[model samples]
Target: MQRFDGRVALVTAAAQGIGAAVARRIAAEGGSVIVTDLQEDKVAELAAELGDRALAVRVDVTSRADLDAAVAAGVERFGRLDLLVNNAGACVVTAMPEDTTAEEWHRQLDLTLVSAAQSIQAALPHLLKTRGNVVTISSVNGLAAFGNLEYSAAKAGQLAMTQNFAARFGSSGVRFNVVAPGTIRTPNWDNQPDALDRLAKLYPLGRVGEPEDIAAAVAFLGSDDAAWITGHTLPVEGGVLTGPSALDLTPKGPFRKEQ
Candidate 1:
């Protein structure tokens, strides 16, 4: 709908899946997008697919230098950054508390939490100049307990960072918010059969969410329509946190009939 016309957006992990979907939506709405990811080839390919509206940059979110380079590239190409989507994140699919070594914990934290912080830090000055906004792709697990402890912890940290940035930059005209998706159907879910089933059951919608579902919320939050929305953790979880039905009197059942 051209909601982002004349704007510039920088989206991390934009090579595929949710990040790619977000980038595509922003571009479709007339926003110039910088697609960043560690997968250089994939990002380049997608950028090409998006044509001149997008620029591809290789960035390892955990590396300050990489993030700096990415921001610099965006400013160089687009002249200014109007929005930042911290969509880069990874999960630990096979580790429990006892099994999660320090290295593993740091790996998860660095990719999910610290990476976004670094990107924000690098892009803050440009964002300040433009009075831009930041949208972080956190998870529902950030607010409540979930199976992946390390991932949840990292996402919680991201949510906290979003609030801190929003409060700190509010006066400077920079807005920050978090979008917490429940169980989105992305490539990350490809081999996670157990996780898929569990999440599908937990969601009252009786199905997994789509990347566009999350992206649509992000697009709104990043637009002028959401100018008043900042420092909020918006859950796009399809009623997962609303608890089970009381009338059923059973621990589990199809919450609603499928349409």
Candidate 2:
């Protein structure tokens, strides 16, 4: 369970949702986690909850300076970096390709893709020192045709970046991989009516994912168990990507089971 006892992990957007879940999971498994998010108070609270094993930093991943400072602070606190979870991202708006404005496209690319690249660059030295790994939070949207065109494109870039890093850093003892989640139950759907229920039906498992589901996958990729695993995309989506949803494929008439 303590796969990362002496390790230090830096997770962005750690204030809530998948980010927070990843931070919590890492900390629970005996890792020192640097929880970075735009919300200073929430980050501080979460850090407090995690006790001294967690450090909070206000980092706007879009800002290179902020990311550098966060990485610096983590190294200063934990002495080295073992994992970097690029979790700060959002689907700002959902629109068809034609309806997506240039501004939105750039924003999506910068936050979801470019930020991860910058963070990796900043953490590279320390990671090299520790022979650490990077596990980025991508999405199933990137693996298949889903809504949010700009977001999907940016997320796809994360997967590509992982492969590039894995190929380039494999000899260096550093690994890179991605966790592509499908319809996770996060705060982003808070205002929607029966959102989890609606989304659950679309998954082959008959239920959507919880943030912890993705967190578990991330823990594996970041742990020593995954020492040989790199450039891989682990779909932690309750079987959404496996095939068609059972809900959508139920037999009708005589083939249908009696209720």
lDDT values of the candidates? 0.90, 0.92
In the order shown, the candidates' Cα RMSDs to the true structure are: 4.3, 2.6
Q: Name the best candidate (by TM-score).
A: 2
The estimated TM-scores of all candidates read 0.91, 0.95
lDDT of 1 by residue, 1-259 (tens): 5899889999999988899999999988899999999899999999998899899999989899999998999899989999999999988675668887899988899999999999999999899999999999999889998779999999999988899888888988889999999889888777876787666766677777899998999999999999998999999988888964233456485587669
For model 1, the run of ten residues with the poorest summed lDDT:
244-253
Instruction: List residue ranges in candidate 1 displaced over 4 A.
Output: 192-198, 244-259
Please give the range of 10 consecutive residues that has the lowest summed lDDT in model 2. 248-257
Task: Evaluate model 1: give its TM-score.
Answer: 0.91
Clashes of each: 0, 0
Residue 110 lDDT, candidate 1, scale 0-100: 90
**Model 2 agreement with the true structure over 100-177: per-residue lDDT tens digits:** 778888989999999999999999999999999999999999999887889999999999999999999999999999
